[model samples]
Target chain A: MAKGGKTLGEEALQQVARRFAVLGEPMRLRILQSLMDGELPVNSLVEATGGTQTNVSRHLQTLAAAGLVARRREGAQVFYSVADPSIFELCELVCGGIRKSLAAQAGSLR
Target chain B: MAKGGKTLGEEALQQVARRFAVLGEPMRLRILQSLMDGELPVNSLVEATGGTQTNVSRHLQTLAAAGLVARRREGAQVFYSVADPSIFELCELVCGGIRKSLAAQAGSLR
Candidate 1:
């Protein structure tokens, strides 16, 4: 998406950055990763991350707002699961992309 | 990659968070986005995003430290570019994943 005329100014970039900032928290990453498995309850999520209930709940709410994860009321418990696997693809691709770039840089150094 | 026993503790999450934090900046996103267009010089990058030299330089360091971007000196001026396209995949995937997740939630609400 080349902005031949520089269409994507700081404002547009900031919008995307907000989403990235929400994902900046490690607990959020772990939370998102957990959702990768399937929908899981809040208690189970807390146990999975070994994080405080308050912390886990906070991160879940952020991810939910970003559309990265979702929550569902399963009877007495509230299950927090990933919004979808497409996010996984993004994680894998981004990681893969950076790894590949690093390898290429290393190659030039040789 | 199941963390059957919470292999990814809070520490691991912090490491990932730092990386995310670097990407969290708007100027950095624009920088990374421009790098997506193969590779470009620092001046071109600055012009593309309409940001200051100092801001661009600072962001480049953060991105480089995170292994998300790289640089090469072309004679006197330095050319900075994204570490790789895979990072693009991550961006696309993350955005797409979240969009999909949100859509699903909206559906459930209906």
Candidate 2:
């Protein structure tokens, strides 16, 4: 995105930082990873992440507030799915960056 | 890139989370944005980011510790530059994601 070519204003910068902050938690990332395949109910997410129902639900709320995940209700059950497909790409970029950083560190150690 | 296809183990997940958490701070992001073009001395970053020398230096230390920025000592002055070019791409992806999210919200409102 050429958007990176220009400097971001304060508000926009904060928005960007907020998104990163939202994804910074270990449990939050775990929950997102659990939903990588598709949508799942709260119970499934709880099982998939090995988090308690309450903890999973709390993270879901945070993710929903960030607009990174979508929520749906069917009867008494709640289902959640990734609202933004770009999220996977974001994670991919971070992983790639980490790998490069590690490789650089190893090279420096040599 | 394809690394995102596999689930990250606990240690790796924490590392990823740590990277994200480091980027979460507004002041740190500001410092990074200031250095986006090229390397600069501490004084120049202070002027560009409008942060005090102490504040800018602190953020630089955080960025350096995260291995996101590189530091060099030229004579008595310290210079900093982006250690990872992937950082630009990461911010670009994030900006794109935020644009899409805002667009979706606008559509919902319409």
Candidate 3:
């Protein structure tokens, strides 16, 4: 928990960094977007992301390791879904910021 | 602009990943935190982050490239500030998600 007027300790900062690193790959973001609506099997993720099954699985493993997504085993197929909804908020914040920055740059050009 | 019921295109996803990669470093996060209140010169950022001036300046460059922060020249001194306030929101979202994940893991252990 953040204390009032207190700086974040080193450990907390590192944890935040790790989370950002997990989201730093474009393919991973695409996979996450595919899973936004509901859990999806590996093949579905591959189709949605237009990535190979190996590549999608690798990214899914990383996302799961970071606790961004949850994996469930049902018979032979494994489905992945977002374990944390906050990811959408993070993406929206970043995307919105990019839009604002672009608009500012355009304004300055005029 | 995101269309209704449309998925993000590759270019947009790449831009988002670039933004996340810029923020994936703890040192960069620390610099951003220091500048949260207001703009600060390079030396001030170095002191606040306990990082070398060169390293801090390098990270600042990356951040500025990503449009997350902006730099201004004040005579011989250069100051940096969060150009996009959305950064704080993104950090808060990721940090909150991490906290929730940790709590869930702890609960499962009990």
Candidate 3 Cα misplacement greater than 4 A, ranges: none
Docking class of 1: medium
iRMS per model, in Å, is 3.0, 0.8, 0.8
Candidate order by DockQ, decreasing, is 3, 2, 1
lDDT of each residue in A30-106, candidate 2, tens digit only: 99988888999999999988999999999999999888999999999999999998888877888889988999899
Candidate 2 chain A least-lDDT 10 residues: A1-10
Model 1 spans with C-alpha error above 4 angstroms: A1-12, A101-110, B1-17, B98-110
Q: What is the lDDT of residue B37 in candidate 2?
A: 85
Candidate 3, pairs of clashing residues: none
Q: Number of backbone collisions per candidate, in order? A: 1, 0, 0
Write down the worst ten-residue block by lDDT for model 2 chain B. B1-10
What overall lDDT goes with each candidate model? 0.71, 0.89, 0.88
**Model 2 / residue B44 / CA error / Å:** 1.1
Chain A TM-score from candidate 3: 0.93
Q: Which is superior by DockQ, 2 or 3?
A: 3
